[model samples]
Target: MSANTLRAECATPGTQHVETGHRVATRSAVLRYPSLTTTVPKEFVHRASVAEVMLTDWERREDHRFVVTAQWPRSHSFFTTANGCHDPLIAAETLRQAGSLLAHAEYGVPLGHHFLMWDLSLTVLPEHLSVGDAPAALDIDVVCSDIKTRRGSLAGFRYATVMRRAGHVVATGGASFTCVAPHVYQRLRAHRLSGAGAQLPLTAPTAPQDVGRVSPTDVVLSPIGQRDRWQLRVDTRHPVLFEHPVDHIPGMMLLEAARQATVATLGEGVTPLSVIAEFSRYAELDAPCVIEARRLPRTEHEEAVEVTGHQDGEQVVRSTVTAAASAG
Candidate 1:
């Protein structure tokens, strides 16, 4: 149909597969699609660089179900892990891009619309995340639920995704978000829209090794002279975290802050395997944001921590990170 729209042809069970543009073949449980050779349009994922787009292709199975494909490089500039496992945040970003792509390509959302994330979570099997010699090919089965609409335009929805690598389950996660038109987003944001506000001065960051990060630039927490407490480090100049200009701190950045805080709280030799982050309000860049972590009751199997971000005396984000001793 249109360039921005996705066209899919479904095949019935026990029929010879036909390939044209996009084909969907029914398997026992998961649907299969043709091998994807290129990434989707960068705009669909709301990314400025094509190198940053993780979604390769998507095919709608039903009104609310879809199958998507993606490829992860053996090494990533920002998502690399010192523990020799693929960064779990890579799964988080892939899930995020899948939702954004589906909203624009399948659900008829305009490109200029804004999606506000309410919560995002991912749980991964660490064994399935090791970096191999070749790039990782992922098949994601996604189901959209709690669909909402207003004035014939998508308003919000919740989605759950199961990501698989080479027929083995790698990660499963879900998120909920609401879409707002450009004018409505402007009204809601008032003067603090993207690229309009100034950020607080960049503070000295904590040691990268203490946070499970190899690069100091990747550390998102600054020392506050208190145990389990630090100030949020917003480095807009960062190439990966701040890939694009924005008025306020991004939810992904806050998630990274939560991850680092958890790592710092739990000490060394631990790797975060599960992360759950909920956003109550935006963490403004102009004001200082405080990040605090408290160890949750530890279990025999895994240790968990609760991290909270506060800005201007208000709670902005609360995250729970569960980490186990890394085998590496």
Candidate 2:
């Protein structure tokens, strides 16, 4: 078969014509060609937003390694920021996406939530690539080095991601992920699926420390509604509970918990859309703080909420969240 025909057959999932069982799945298929040479639509390119840099048409050899290319658009929103990265969550999700691709390709099963990310070590290199800069393209590569399993469960996988502009490395990071069972994976999986991913179930809110409480707070607040705004206070004793020895709470976990708390305080049913947050200062494990959310304008599709985290009357993190109305 011609090279084009071979690539086409390989890109098609569940196609009988492909000899190797290792077919490219939905997310991984983007990496099959050198710089997006495949016939996928341009819309997928746009939807990826900041990830367009890493979803190139780079050729993949039989060794399971791939290279993708992207250009840092000068007009992109992240260019003017301190880190110059729009969202840390996107970085985390990119690692997760890479891990999912590796897991499916190596183990023949989709990755799920049974495993959580315990740690991530990231280094944004000094090199900065601007949109209008002479070198317009960036190189992104992901590779898995070690995978461990225990008791028939996915213990974790260690992988590295490198981001480069014009052949120069701009950012690099390593991630670790634990795996869970297929059923548990399904619930989390449903969120990404169509129709199912539309809205999260609005149940009574629970605090991180409420597990041991004989009577937990059952107040189900609407995080978004006609109300003007919502406010939250995240007070904790010195030596905050579950504070990691690393001096920083896991960014993703803490952000999610804070989002939940904001939603609970709003007293209006709201489904979280996206949050762009920055970790300005570290909160003392024992230090108590306040997180406040103010409702902003609303569009037909989403409502905007502004959030801020403060400790000892000083701001630590600030975020603006967009959420959809709850299904109920």
Candidate 3:
């Protein structure tokens, strides 16, 4: 492959299975070619890939662990907080991009294919919920062993990632993904609806600060008659969220809506430190998806928020967002 084309896998799955984390150290026999640099072109990447967390330098020293490096740029969608800490989502995306890209390089994951986030749980240790802009020098060691194949064409796997600065723990989380190749994705459902431009019934939008978005247009859902509830605004033209059309509501849009709700309820200054979300069904664009967020008690230094979306009376999206106490 050319320099920018692809990097084929050359390493073998070594026999040495060492305990890299708190979990038992049984390595996965199914996993092959443990490490690889990401080769997915920037354009093919679903998200705006320019400032994303794609892996560069990669090396696998053990069956359960691979050491790789990724960076979040200043132009990152979620900018650094005033305290100079990177968003927890950045760390989450780091784990995601690393694994997906590695899968593409090592397992011949098709270029047009993409992995959908089914379940994700990430937590920041500190009370402030801020993982400082740990530079590119810091390498995130990922341990992956849980890989299961579906009956048809799907594959499910979970990854455990840890981020640190100067050997100090910054954040940790484990997330599960469902792989959806291009052919499989196209077969699922059709993209967009009949009236793409018709206006939907919606309450006036609250300010960007109310939803934690830097700009009002960034907010995907608008307020409803009920408090702490919103009607998902289906706009295919959204540059960042909806770069292209899709059959269902994009997972990132749900995450962003939940994040905005959590921040809106928490009010200003608080930042989303960690979030755990589960997608049960597709929030179709043809109908209205009612979003509701409930604030949990201040259990830890950081407060908690629960957001859910209902479509046709069935729960489609659910998220538990934890925000650190606002910095002064």
Which candidate number maximizes TM-score? 1
Best by lDDT: 1
Task: Report the C-alpha displacement of residue 274, candidate 3, in angstroms.
Answer: 1.9
Model 2 earns a TM-score of: 0.40
Q: What range of 10 consecutive residues in model 1 has the weakest lDDT sum? A: 1-10
> How far out, in Å, is residue 173 in model 3?
1.3
Task: Give the local distance difference test score of model 2.
Answer: 0.45
Go through the candidates in order and give the clash count of each: 0, 22, 0
Query: Which residue pairs clash within candidate 3?
Result: none
The candidate with the higher TM-score, 2 or 3, is 3
Rank candidates by lDDT, best first: 1, 3, 2
lDDT of 3 by residue, 1-328 (tens): 1223445545355645667677555444444564455534553345454544355555565765766665555445444443555666666666666667555544445667757777777776554334444443346777876776666433757778786656766778777776776666766643443345344443445677777666666777687667898888767666656656565677777877888788778897667778898988767766788889998978646788999999889998899998776544
Worst 10 residues of 3 by lDDT: 189-198
| Candidate 1: residue 128 Cα off by (Å) | 0.6
The 0-to-1 C-alpha lDDT of every candidate, in the order given, reads 0.88, 0.45, 0.67
